[model samples]
Target: MDLLKSLLVSASGLKAQNGRMRIIAENVANANSTGRTPQDDPYRRKIATFRSHFDKELGAEKVELGKVARDESDFDTRYEPGHPAADANGYVKLPNVNTLIETVDMREAQRSYEANLNVIESTRTMLQRTIDILKS
Candidate 1:
């Protein structure tokens, strides 16, 4: 029963990591995106938050994905006179996304996802072994 609970917990972790990876991917994909007009704002980087709460049925504190929040940091500006979205000063506002940061976040999320998968696999293997021993 505890093994099953661990499996569930790990599954929750995997789900959270999956959501995080998606956000990171979106940030990476929109790293070069700019606003349509000087008055408009480009894509803002999104961050994934996690929280743990007691599950009544499982009787355990399980992790879950929290709300996705936008990064409020200032956008990078570049001077490009010919750009359509350039401002009066020939400056264009770029998305707050940084590819390097997104890449690092993606790697971290991948590792966490793999770790959770490993836990699930290991639990299943042990459960199978226990059943085999009982049958013998």
Candidate 2:
């Protein structure tokens, strides 16, 4: 029963991490996206959030992907007078997404996903061994 609960918990974590990675990928994909016009805003970075709650049936705390929030940080600016999205001052607004930070976040999410998978695998192995012993 405890093993089953562990599996459920780990599965929840895996799902959460997967969602986080997807959000990170989206941010990376739009890292260089710019506004079509000077008055428009560029792509905004999105942040993934997680929520944890106790599962009554599983008798364990499980994590889940929560609402994606937009980053409120200021956008970067570049001097590009000829650009279509350039402002009157010859400065173009850049997306808030930072590839370096996104890369780091992706790595962390991947590691977390792997860890949850490992826990699930380990639990399955232990359950299999238990069944084998019982059969013997």
For this target, which candidate reaches the highest lDDT against the unseen true structure?
A: 2
**Which stretches in model 2 have alpha-carbon errors above 4 Å?**
none
For candidate 2, lDDT tens digit of each residue in 1-136? 6899989999999999999999999999998899999998999999999999988877889999999999999999999999999999999999999899999999999999999999999999999999999999
Q: Model 1 compared with the native: what TM-score?
A: 0.97
Clashes of each: 0, 0
Looking at candidate 1, what is the lDDT of residue 110? 97
> 2-104, model 1: which lDDT tens digit per residue?
8999999999999999989988888988999998888888899999999999999998878888999999999999999898899999999999988988888
Residue 96 lDDT (model 2) = 97
Candidate 1 stretches with Cα past 4 Å from truth are none
Output the TM-score of candidate 2. Answer: 0.97
Q: Weakest 10 consecutive residues, lDDT, candidate 1?
A: 59-68
